[model samples]
Structures are given as structure tokens and as C-alpha cells.
Target: MTDLIACTRAEFARLRRWPAFWIILGTWIVLNLVFAYLFNYLAYATGSSMRMSNGQPRAILLQQMLPAAVPEVFTQGMAMFGGALMLVLGALVTGSGYGWGTWKTVFTQGPSRARVAGGTVLALAVVVVALVLTAFVVDTGVAAIIGTVQHQSLALPGAGRSLLGILTGAVILGMWTLAGAVIGVLARGPALAVGLGLVWVLVVENLLRGVASIFAPIRAITDHLPGTAAGSLAGAMRTISGEPTPGVLDILSRPASFVVLAVYIVVFAVAMMWLLHRRDMA
Candidate 1:
């Protein structure tokens, strides 16, 4: 445990100086800002309305546009773009150690292979959580400003519910990051790990999900895929804004999705540990 903590601290210190980490984080913030503004602008122009349960007409444009609509915005952004970016970030962070021969040096320095791997994962988790919270803060600030300017209500989802949704999104992204780290360790390079991870996320997952729609049998299997399960987890957040929920499919219930995501994380972590222990890192 002492060695693991030391390694984790070292990883954190290294990441603090890593430009890619900041670049990705900055990009995420900027993208969220742009989208928040765009969505608000659309709401202002086209305008939207819906009937409340009490049969009263409600203006949904502000609800959909403002940061007060965080559940909707957070889940949509994370599930769609943020998740993919995290996978790449994870791959790069882990694969860089091997690319630069740092892994070899670290292994030779006397730490157990498991401790080294655990340290990397711990660092990645910390970074991921910080990034996720930063995103939430930035988006919320942007939305609040917009709402103030437009004289719109800044009503938000229940605190407990919103926090739970954020937590779920974080877990999903964390899993993606770990999976990418595993690929990095196995591939021993960022390029292949990132390329393969992107293909799996963008092409393979989409293709399988689409096919599942036409064929029932395939759907059953594809629904359990990591990406699919992640989407389900994110979708569990209720969007009171009445906007259409993002994502192509959501077959699993929230509890079931959580279980599947947990399975993926455990499997990836175990695979990474196994590879680290058996592979000749020298």
C-alpha cells in the first residue's frame, strides 16, 4: 500500500506537468460552452412549449437551454463526446509510459507490477473525477448566466437526483478510461490503443447496435456491450426539461446497466493486472 501510494503520487505529479491533460480539459470546457450557447440560442429562436401534467402550457425552451437543465446537458455531453475523449486520454496517459520507456525504469525500481498498475489507475481516476467536476461547474455557470440574461427560470433537477446522475456519468467515463488504459498496456503504444479504442467505440459499437435493432438476437448481445451499458447508465438520469433523450438505444434498466458497467471495469482492471504481471516489461 505504501508503494502504491508513492507511485500514485508520482503519477499525479507527472500528470500535473503533462500538456495533453490540460489541452483535453480545456477543449472539453470550450466545447461545453459553445454547445450551451448554441442550445440556448436555438431555444430563443425556434422556441418550444409543452403541456405540464396539470394541463398548463410550459415554456420548455429555457429549460432545455439553461444550465438549470444540467441533467440533460451533462448526460448528453458525457455519453456522446466526453466518453470518447476520456478513452483517448486514458490510452495516452498509460501508453506514454511505455512509449517513453518509463515503464521499464519504474518496473526495475523495485515496485511490484500490481502496485505500479494500481498507481496508474489511481492517477487516472483522480484526473477523470476532477475533469468531470470541472465540466459540471463550467456548464452550470454558463447556463446560469444565460438564464439570467434571458430572464428564464433557473430551475434544476433535485439535488440528490442530479448528484446521482453526475456520479453515474463519472463511473461510466472512469470505466472507459480504464478500458483504454488496459488497451494501452496490452498494445504497448498509444497509437494502436487509441486507434483500436476509437474503432470499437465509433464503428463497431454503432454497427452492432444498429444491427441489433433489426435482429433481436444480436440486439440482446450488443445491448450488453460496454458502450451500450455506459449509455444506459447515463440515460438513467431523468431529464425534467422534456427534451428528447440522446442515444440510439437504451435497453437495460439503471440497476442492470450499473451491473454491466461494473463488470466491464473489473474485467478491464483484471486484464491489465494480468498483463502487467506476465509480460516482460524490460
Candidate 2:
């Protein structure tokens, strides 16, 4: 336990100097500011109540752009747009370690390969949590400030739930990044790792979905695929179709999606260890 903790700390120190974290964090702040302004501007244009539920004036303005519920709107927006960007950020988090070529050094530092893998995951988890927390704080602050300027209240039902969803979604988004890092460790190159991660997420997943439609057996299992399971875990909102893909039971009752994600993490960690044991390092 002490060894793991020490490794975790060492990994954290290494990741702190990464440029990827800063770049992603900066983009997150900028996006939050821009979107908050747009949301407030739309509220002003619509001349909506902008009033608190208690009939008092509000300090934060929550605008309704889509016909769906507020929580649903936020969910879809986060999953489709912000979430995608975050996925890339996740990859960058793990990939940056590869770029620095430090995982090898980590393995050589008396800790076993497994310890190094655990340290990498521990560090990445901390980074993901911090990144997501920062995004939510910056976004909420920007919206609140703008709404206060406009004399609009910013409270909404399920706001807290939506925030939690974003945080979990960010973690789920990191799965691909983690996968790529594993691949990067095996391949000893960043290009293949990034390309494979993106292709799997953007192309292969979609292709799998399309193929599953015509093949009954594939359809049976494809729903549990990484992309599908990530979407399920994320609980992203869809409007054109108000249908929830995973359903309440699937998310709350069944643990398959989470299990799959866990498997991915474990598999990659083991694979990285295997690579470390076999491969030559400088």
C-alpha cells in the first residue's frame, strides 16, 4: 500500500508539468465563458421570466434553447460537444506521458511494472477529476456572473445531477485515452496510439453499430461495445429521440457497462506491465 501511494505521488508530480493539461484546461475555461454568454444573450432576447422559482429576481440566467427539459439539454450538449473535447483531453492526459517517455523510467524505479501501471492510472484519475471539477466550476461561475449582470436566476432542477453526470462522463471518456496510452506503451510511439484511439472511438465504433443492424448476433453483443457502453454510462440526453438507450434499470441495476469499463482498465494495465517486462527501455 505504501509503495502504491508513493508511486501515485510520483506519477502525480510528473503529470503536473504536462502541457496537455494546461491546454485542455484553458480551452475548457474559454468554452465555458463563450457558452455562458450565448445562453444569457438568448435569455435576454426571449424575454423569459429570468425569475427565480420564489418570484424573486435571479442572479444566474438559465436559458431554454431546445424544446426539451433543461437537464436533458445540458446532458446532450455536454456529451456530444463538451464530452467529445474531453475525450480528446483524456487521451492527451495519458498520451502526454508517452510523449515524455517517462513510463519506462517509472518502471525502472524499483517499483514493479504493475506498480508503475497503477501509478499512471492513479495520476490520470486525479487529473480527470480535477479537470472536470474545474470545468464545472468555471462554467457555473461564468453563467452565474452573466446572469447576475442580467438580473437572471441561474438555478435549475437536476443541475447538481447534470454536474455529476459530467464528472462521470469525463471519467468514462478517459477509457479511450487510457487504451491509447497502453497502445502507446506497447508501440513506443504516440502517433499510432492517438490514431488508434480516435479511429476506434470515431470510426470503428460507428462502423460496428452500422454492421450490427444487419447481423443479429453482432447486434446482440454490440450494445455492450465500448462506445455503446460509454454512452450508457454517460446517460447522455437525446432529443430527436427522447428514448434513453441504457434505461434506468440498466444503469442502476445491471453492472455490465461499468464492469466492461473496469475490464478495459485492468486489461490495459496488465498489458502495459507485460510490455514493460519484455521491452527494452532507455
The whole-model lDDT of each prediction reads 0.76, 0.55
Worst 10 residues of 1 by lDDT: 49-58
In the predicted model 2, the residue pairs found to clash are 58-152, 58-153, 60-152, 60-153, 60-154
RMSD of each: 4.2, 6.9
In order of appearance, the predictions have TM-scores of 0.89, 0.69
Put down candidate 2 lDDT per residue, 1-282, tens digits, no spaces. Answer: 778888889867766776766776577556644443454455455655433221212222334322113334333333233444555654554555556766556666668766766776777667666666665555555556655665656674376666555545454645654665566675566566666666666677778877987887877677776666666655633322322322211322125656777777677656765775666765
Clashes of 2: 5
Question: Cα lDDT of model 1 overall?
Answer: 0.76
Error of 2 at 108 (Å): 3.2
Query: Number of clashes in every candidate structure?
Result: 1, 5
The TM-score that candidate 1 achieves is 0.89
